[model samples]
Target: MGTDISRPEHPPLARRHAWSLAAYRHMLRKRLTGQPAADLKSIADKRWDIAPGEITVSPPAIYLPGQMERVTGWEGQRFYPYVHPGPTMAGGLSIEQGPTRGYLIKNVWLIDGALYKGNASHWLTLKPQRFAPVLVENEIERGAIYCTQNGNSWFGTWLMEDCVTYALACDEGVPVTSAPSARYPLFTQAPPYEDWLGMNPLRLRTAFFHQLVLFDDVSHNRSRHQRYRAMGDKLLTHVEHAPHPGVFILRGHEGDLRLLRNELEVAEHMCVKWGFRVINPLRLDVPTIIAACAGARVVMGVEGSQLVHGVNVLQPGGTVFTLQPPNRFISYYKYMTDRDGQHFAFVVGTPDGDGFTIDINEVERTMDLLPKH
Candidate 1:
């Protein structure tokens, strides 16, 4: 792995008090490309027949008729009972991208409101320029909401990318709004041997946290837990023992077991440093893992899906730090935090330096600027 400076710190201000137009210009560039933004005025202004009592709704492309029947048992059902369809596992029942299209409203419906967990109107729309269009008639019959539960394995990139793309598209629309819920399922469930490489479609859903703190590479290296706990002891407040906190450690199919060994070592070390307990759930469920992160003040790990989990769990203005390969994929942190309206930073470890050394000064500096929740 090689390292290059992708996004570097801005030059120091000679006069901190004086306003710099250059700084504003730099900030503008970062905002436009980094965070979710779309050009969708046509869809935002259109008035759809939002029928009275319609509680849930979504596009038809991402949902499959078979899956709907299985979940809702509404065989040959015509009318939708809710405004927003609840989470579904069907791959096709989702909103599509086009020149700001029309809206579709169906009959009102009811759902287990408890399942509708997370911030309201928190979603990110994406445009899959490469994949074939999945929508049909731009309308879908609303039914029970189905959330996708598979993202960590073969379909991980596809689903995550789709979610990210959706968020960006929505941002482009006039009077932009965030999606209400983002669904992250396990990757192991993905159909075997699905190609992960290629221009996969991106998607975005509403996030649980106002800000996402991503920690990567928890298990890939050595003594990770000790290093993280030492770091957390300095940054977090009210560290508590979670007997069974659902924590998800993302791993690739190849070389993943080795990575897990490394991450486990780190977790063990962290426990020793801060007396912080490690809670490993037998099953890696996304919702449960997210709930645990939601309760956390600081999230630290190697750069991986756990970081993505942190993204979903962090409160607005929360801070995240992940390990960076000496050179490759350095800008990922910036790409995530800047575009998503969250505080992002990275720590690069030298081969000869301490196994873990975070730029505490930088962490403090970033934390100071975070919005008070």
Candidate 2:
């Protein structure tokens, strides 16, 4: 969006193929259902149990920069059994922002000096920061771990901002049930709105170190990234096969859909000309993908959720090229990669209907300036 001289100028496409496909889907849905499903119908069938006082455990409090007494009243004490609620919905239980992090307890969210509490069923009063044993449940062993399921959503938000809280919970040394002996249940039974890597929370649980750690967008802090990187390095051992030194060009989505116009073609061109390895991250298992990212010197891809991998895996000072959609201006990855000590650059492209096209000449120019692999 800014007048950056390095930005690409792409020629507009003659046919809006992506737009046509979207329109067709809309029309077909309207014909079949008379209206589009709004308000999280996707998770209608999937249900979660929020059994309070299941097992009381006293986990240590996670402190932030500006908090006086540890913010502990309603938080550290209780462990939710299977608390899986999708993002805020009208009239539904909208999660309040906690002072320290995202949703941890119902109705109560911690800030700085004071704690904010909401209603009865969805409400509870704030108490003076105190420590007491509370119920906790590891959602992974129960059924599946809840996570945002969208490829085009903010990568750093999903991983660094949200998922880090889950990691924090595990680090508290709360007792958790073992992994399922049979087939693992999908995190959510619903079909994914966007492509995502199928990950088992069991692996994440194993990767966790039982230490009290508070995280707020760890990807933004170099020191925090080091800790996060340690976890990723541990997870890398699970990958049976991985390249030692590589440059990964992440392909967004899997199978048919793509986030950017001509992304596959662009990835192929880069691989042929610059010896970059094109990877569809969703195609590989979680551990393999993590290993590829951890070992890579450079990660290139259209701005999307897949870049979250860069936060956990890329070495400090690694380089990332975030090809942004020209019509849609987003700064999430730019700030995240920068905070993680990664040299970040953006190349804005021309929008072609729903997706956008990147200029090959601009890509080549940027590649020439980057350190040779």
Candidate 3:
């Protein structure tokens, strides 16, 4: 249930130049027709005035594509296309929406990072693009950071994997700035990004960092989850009388193939009668959500990004029952949970007209089918 994740390698200078030329032609063509061309600069690698060691990389314009049948097979189920192509013009200017064509960014300062949202694009698209050596904005004045609003729903992207980027930048001895942007509040509830990495926020982002590092998605690494779980445990110490340890039934609120048409009502009734805590994650913050799921042995929900929180909190060897919506059976979560040693299972509901509905008996069967701990 896994597909190869192709990592972008730095191409030869000649080939890079060719790519640049091709990109320029493409942009020119789009421009003649009055299309947005924001990614034209991102096609070629550019060098700054900083020394080689001071600014260590010339990265390509990273383009992570939307879900494909060739990769996930679930693309056939989606009602709309994964990512829309062409120039993304908002207010007569090109906007960066990676995975789609014409999205390119170069000379991105590490200090004040940008946020790309929706589904798994934040980590899959934006984060990996930051895998270069450059001056971070955190080492400069309070207002020096450049911020941009790109997409919708940052969701859970500001977790451990995001913090590790700064940690890696600091290790590389890269000059970082100390500027704080207003966008920081929207990114995380915490004051300093460095605290998550177990470092002093001021010292880490303000000084030279000598190390560089990279990471895949969160569930691919257990130690990362362990670190997150420890952080969750520490946070839970402050909550007086948190929910008792048990199974959790995650009720999803948003989606085309959502748990609707009395399916959720039936599911909720059964879940409550069966000793499960029904949680609508949309109402909770990241820590509180993690704290709730960390204590549970089984987590069940309709498959979506919010279910990602389940993998984050559910312990190793936990059970995740994903409710698939007819043809839209994507395996992103299954791939993750399986890698993390969690028992992953799913039940495709009966297609009820355009959407679908799950019989509570299916839930009962899934519950019984779970491996006993």
TM-scores for every candidate against the unseen true structure: 0.33, 0.48, 0.50
Residue 57 error, candidate 2, Å:
40
lDDT of 1 by residue, 223-282 (tens): 222232232232223333333222324332232221322445545554554332344422
Model 2 RMSD in angstroms: 21.1
lDDT at residue 63 of model 1 (Cα atoms) = 19
Clashes of each: 80, 8, 21
Model 3 stretches with alpha carbons more than 4 Å out: 1-170, 173-252, 255-259, 285-288
Off by over 4 Å in 2: 1-156, 171-219, 239-258, 371-373
- lDDT of model 1, residue 367: 37
Name the top TM-score candidate. Answer: 3
Which scores greater on TM-score, model 1 or model 3?
3
lDDT of each: 0.29, 0.40, 0.39
lDDT of 3 by residue, 1-373 (tens): 1111111121221211101122234334655867544332233233121111111111111111221221222532221113221111011222221121112222222222321111111121222222222332221211111111211123333443344233333332221223333333334443332343344323222111122122222222333444455554554454443333344445455634455455566556656766666666667765566566655776777766556555555666676776666556654454344435666666666666665676676667656766676
CA shift of 190, model 3, Å = 8.4
Q: Which residue runs does candidate 1 get wrong by more than 4 Å? A: 1-160, 164-186, 189-262, 272-283, 351-373
Q: CA RMSD for every model? A: 24.6, 21.1, 15.3
